[model samples]
Target: QLERGNLRTSWRKEHGHLRRAPVRASPLWNAKQRSVAAMRARVSRRPHRPSAKPKPAVSPLMLALVCCLCLFPPCLIWLLWRPSLGQRSWFRSPSPLPPPSPLAPLGEGNWTSALFLGDSSFVAAVHAAGHAFDAELVDERRPPLLVTVAEKADSPLLQNFLQSSILKHELRHWLVVALDSGVCEDLPDDVQWMACVSVPAQQEPADTAEPAMARPVNVKAQVLWATVKLGYDSLLVDTDVAFLQNPLPVLADYDRAHQQVRCGSAGAEPFLPHYPWLGAHVAESASTCESVIDLQAQRDEEHGIGAGFMRVKATPGGLLLLSRAMALSLKAPELTLQQSVSQAVGQLRGVITANTLPPATFPSRLVHLARPSRVFAYHQPCPKCVVVHSSWLTGHAAKVWRMKDQMLWSLDGPKKYYSDPKRKYIEYSNPSSMASQEAELNALKAAFMLGAMLDRTVILPEFRCHRCPTADGKGTTPKCSDMVTRCSLGAFGQLDLAKFAGAIPEDLFRERMFRYNPLTPKSAWGGSLFDSPVHLSFDSGKGGIGSLQASPEPGWEIQSSRAPEILSGAEVHPDNVLTPAADGSPTEDEVVAWFGSQTAPVLRFEHLYGLRPQFRHPARASAFDAMWNRATGM
Candidate 1:
């Protein structure tokens, strides 16, 4: 109450009011009075002191001097170690490799190795020719040379390679290294080739009971190393590979990218270093190089990069890598070429780097054969592939047949034999179902015999199989993993049907039946039997079992719905009759007398299931047996 009264007096004095009107002692007025009294009491208790003078500001020079004093030791230490500071990179890039020395002329140094023996001059001349031919390409983007080593046994394959290159206009850039005289003779006179006797001619001496020096499982590396060291980059390919396109342009891109790649950069992701097959290749893809599985000696070793297709540069690293590989191959003769190269790469991992060609564009057999599509026919799974290495599949015959089916074959010099107008053909369909491969083969034997007897080329049907047969059909049976689920004629029996008995390729039916064939007019084809000539239906009497009479009485009949039109035409003759025989072989003269008078270009057999024609003559019987073996290999 006293505090409120004092506050009310102070307020009245401040307002200068003489009359003391009733003033409200609100909470705000009482609080202000207490704060004023507290301040007055604090002031009353304080001791009195004189004010001190302000100190002067420190100079900029003094401030800088103090900072220097604090940092002197560290700065001195840094200055003393300044030389080593620049060597450490903050961004973590790879250490730059020493620049390679300029390539010298071939014979300048001790270029001869154990593999090459002493063929320095010969190799130098070969490289000079290669450089000259590459210069003729006029395109600087192309690789320096494309090379392959071949012997007499690989003549067909060499022919195939040459033919493919000629088609793609890449023949001029090729440099074939011949391993023997036979290969040299097989090569065209105009082709750029050289004979290298680096490998031993004879494996063993006749007098020695002991084994001889084990020859290299593959001499591809030695040839490649010898050629690359001759001062030019080279693309080494196997003879079995079919060049679908000029691979030099694609390989040149790889080479350029490889040249620009650093040891540890984002640009190196798409590229692989030299000799990539250090261990087993896992999860193969479009960009990866394939590893060859060596099955020799039942080893089944799946190591080493495929030597079939390699793009080697002439850098010091490249030379060193090939050198080590050649040395390893020489030391370990039992190792396959792929295995030797792989071992070398494993040893020289840090010393050198190489680039692997993308297997998608340069496919091996493993990549291509695994495709569900018809790879050999339509170039499926890799139509844009530059080169298709048809390795892994054994035998030259298999390679030849596959290439022919793909229409990449020029062994016959680009002639379309399947569509020849002068040729007369016999067509037949496969049985509705076959119990086994043997059953189908028996049917094939019947067709082949009929073709030989009638002197007409038999058209093959799509041969179905549970598993792909071995290339020659005489090797080990294929595993279940090699089974192609669809109708594949490649798995069919590989025989010289053309030589033993007249036969055409499966191109007729493979290219959408006879419609795609040029010999058969497109307008005449109405998707009926009428599209062809007379459709002869043989009658085996009751129960589909009876002996065919030599005379033309109900032996055969025209089964086509268009039989009237066919009969109206003069193409069919009365003697053009044949029937399935139950017993007894027909004489050659009687058989000819029965069906030799027909003038039709295409003989359509409705169903030749039970038709088994046999000759009575001993000579003819012997010939037929030989033909049978060639057809079915039974």
Candidate 2:
């Protein structure tokens, strides 16, 4: 077959009649392509004809002039403005990632970290709170890291804050941004701290005419930026705050709703539920303006999120707010952190969404501190408050006292106070025999002073009142007492009581404290202490220690009097100073001896209405009067 084929092919080639192997066609296989190429060639060949007037060549000078004319303005502008270009970032570069945060290695799941600001002074507090969570048990969700910033490794304010938070809350995760050297050495090795040596010293605006980014609040803003930039949603909690319940869940719920609404409302009107950011003084009516941020700006500057207890998300709006606040703070050094944030929010209203924490869940010092009645009304049982911020008070000591009074203090030990077996407690009731609030108050004052002298924690008695302070705080509300207005302590009295609590050591008790104390003695349960828990057997309607037997006393008629009056054998004296001893009866030392003789864990008194302390030194009397005046707001 091969030979036959080869022979056929040869024959065909020789004869020029063999179906010659189909020759490859030209690349310009179509007539149209060939025609087009021919036309192009013909036109090229005929294009040598010169125009009647030939164009002149561009001179080097003219060319340079044209180029300069076109580019000079922009180049000059750029050169002149290049210095300011850094200030106006049209396209912001990614913020340099902070070295892995101390919070990263903690908790297993995604969790919001709690941020605190402090310095060297807070070292003790930080150490005390370092192991807020149990180390042995693995937490499915890590506790929020308590992050703080300080000017120096041992800044005083920061230290104070550490003390406050450590004592008040059992914090889990911890991270510290030590601005200066030695923090690592100062703090325990277990403490997770990052040294930020680059942080500039805080600058006072008065010292410099030009704005600087050295303000404490400004630095805080910068820290917030870095945190969110690292994808952390943080709870900015002041050290003064006390966690009654875990506030994270509440904050998380709000954040989830916030994100959901933001995501769901794309291309539609935003959902902004109005609540109080500062206090109830701000209006809650739905704003007519389309943007909530604008509405916030229009509201009083005093109103907005409380800087002390803020929930900062890592979302775009949150990041934008933080960045803008930081920039604004630098530009306007006079503005406070809260103010800068407000201004930034106003500017970013179009793109941002904000909501106030539910007041019922998160009560603040701003509203409750000024109005003591509200504190009791809404926060007494504190049925719903997740966290209580102890702020608006003047000093750290004052904040600590307030927390203790509210049964919110955690640093000393467990939440229970007056539980120490070594410590003694004195108990009394609103003298059922006394009819007037004034009489009852006098009794309370006497009891309080007596407790102080005895080194006992006075379990405060509930007042029997004809009228209670109205909820509005404007007037009295009548109780259902046979035709007369039956009342408990009035709002005014509560205010005075708050002052008293802040002024003194944690020596006095509110009914709630006694009722809530887990260590409350079984013998003390029968009395009608705020409707005793059903689990405790009730012996009588008398709450608290009312049912307990009164300590046996030979002489119950004790009256307070000045030493000079007693020494002079006279009743009247210029000084109001009174001793623990009864006037015309016993010496101060004798009085101490009498109380000291008692071996009882609790000394129950029938009533202080009739007992008048007899004598005291001038200094003692003055101190007593001061305490009395503060407690009564007289």
Candidate 3:
């Protein structure tokens, strides 16, 4: 009270006579204060300002909401501008590798050793190729290429170094680390894929969704790991590849070794099957003949083939480095980390310096299995090539070196090496785009099949197959018989499935189905059922599944909605099985990848023989019946 009294007296003393002049207030301050008071008054009246543009008389709750909305615009723009730094990265540090140790004695200065490392699991193929060149399989305890797999899947470097066609380490002291591709790597991209009964093109089943899953047990990482662990040296080889003679006598010149690679050959598709047995690969002495069907072992042993031969000179330090790489790839938490392994080995020095004087087999060196009698025979009794790879265009590889014969080049000349005929804004030259197309094709096929099985229709934009056969006389013949043509499905509409059967690759489906499926029509099963035997040039055997005199009717509706697991095998008798679609596995991605890549038209010849219902398109009755009548020629 005293303080108030003192303030009142001071005011009275200063303004008692100040009333002579009227105090004029500025509109700016008064307006601001009034506005502020008005704002405050809003809370006492109503929470929202009905006159404000955005109804701004905000409540504590509404103010918070407006702040969030204003903030979102900038946040979303930032996200759009940024790239995922390590989102899909395959890079890793150097794998933990064993010390490089020599398998052969340097006492014989430069006397090199060659080892074949690949999916050469077939005992017959191994023995036939080994004995053919008087070569021996180094099954003795030795280290394989280093690798790791934290998650069960092949890393990038594993595919390029071991599962790919290029023989990066074709060493004199060779070591082959063979493994199954299906078990080692995710054969198909796991994303943008589905596993379900019905997948409508527009939307998918919401309640049950599973990630696209593919498991890879990398061959390179495993081999590198084995090499480090075993402490031995060897030359690596793919079971699908072959040699004219034992490379033992061929390692005289370089600091290391040299083997031919069909640079222009068709890149081996990762999903293809390979030699399928591990037990007798060495002691049996495989390379005795041309075709190695006898090594016909169980189906599970080799899910896919290794890329080809890689020559490694048995340097004491080399194995150590590889072992280190292997360690990084195969460690418990992360197995088959290929990028790390590759970075380590890529540190090794070398380049492709072709020998001035080439070998005879090289005159027509690498012959890719364009045809699907597809069992590869390594170093047949007398090898014709210094080396051969599993590349699809291997048949044309020799043409690159054959300066004498411009005629040797086949149609499939430019693989990853050459550019397609130019057209503005075309995608063949775009690796990134190509990958996307392949992904979409695989996704579409998967969706279509799943939808069909569930008696539903799936809409998909039309696309191209993985490969396409050359137009008649459309491609050049640089080699004797190899050929290729542009096959990106987007460029060309639906492929002539019959024409593309060879180039698109038939084994992914055929081998998977016929490996031990006694019910499959043997002769035409590996090849296209629609293709005539006379046109097939890869057969060294009595062409066709001649044994399929009578095939059983695989009981299923012409357009029945059923699970693949429902399909039973013929061996069990149609009446006594768990399902009708036993041939198809748990996921359809692999099947679709194979199907999408078909360069040929798909003709379920089994339908023609009345071995099964004629319809394959099960989405619509009208479509299925029309196809049935067409196939039956009704």
Alpha-carbon TM-score of each model against the true structure: 0.58, 0.50, 0.25
Candidate 1 wrongly placed segments (more than 4 Å): 1-117, 133-142, 191-218, 256-301, 373-376, 379-381, 413-423, 431-435, 468-490, 493-607, 616-618, 630-633
lDDT per residue, candidate 2, 35-146, as tens digits? 9999999998885776676566877789999998999788767754553342234432223223223333121112122222233343333333333332212212223334
Could you tell me the TM-score of candidate 1?
0.58
Cα deviation at 130, candidate 1, in Å, is 1.9
Candidate 3 Cα lDDT to native: 0.29
Each prediction's number of clashing residue pairs: 2, 31, 124
Which residue ranges in model 3 land beyond 4 Å of their true spot? 1-219, 225-231, 236-308, 313-315, 327-342, 346-634
lDDT of 1 by residue, 428-470 (tens): 5443343245545555566566666677666655554545534
Which one wins on TM-score?
1
- State the lDDT at 314 in candidate 2: 48
* Residue 53 shift from truth in candidate 2, angstroms: 99
Cα lDDT of all candidates, in order? 0.50, 0.49, 0.29
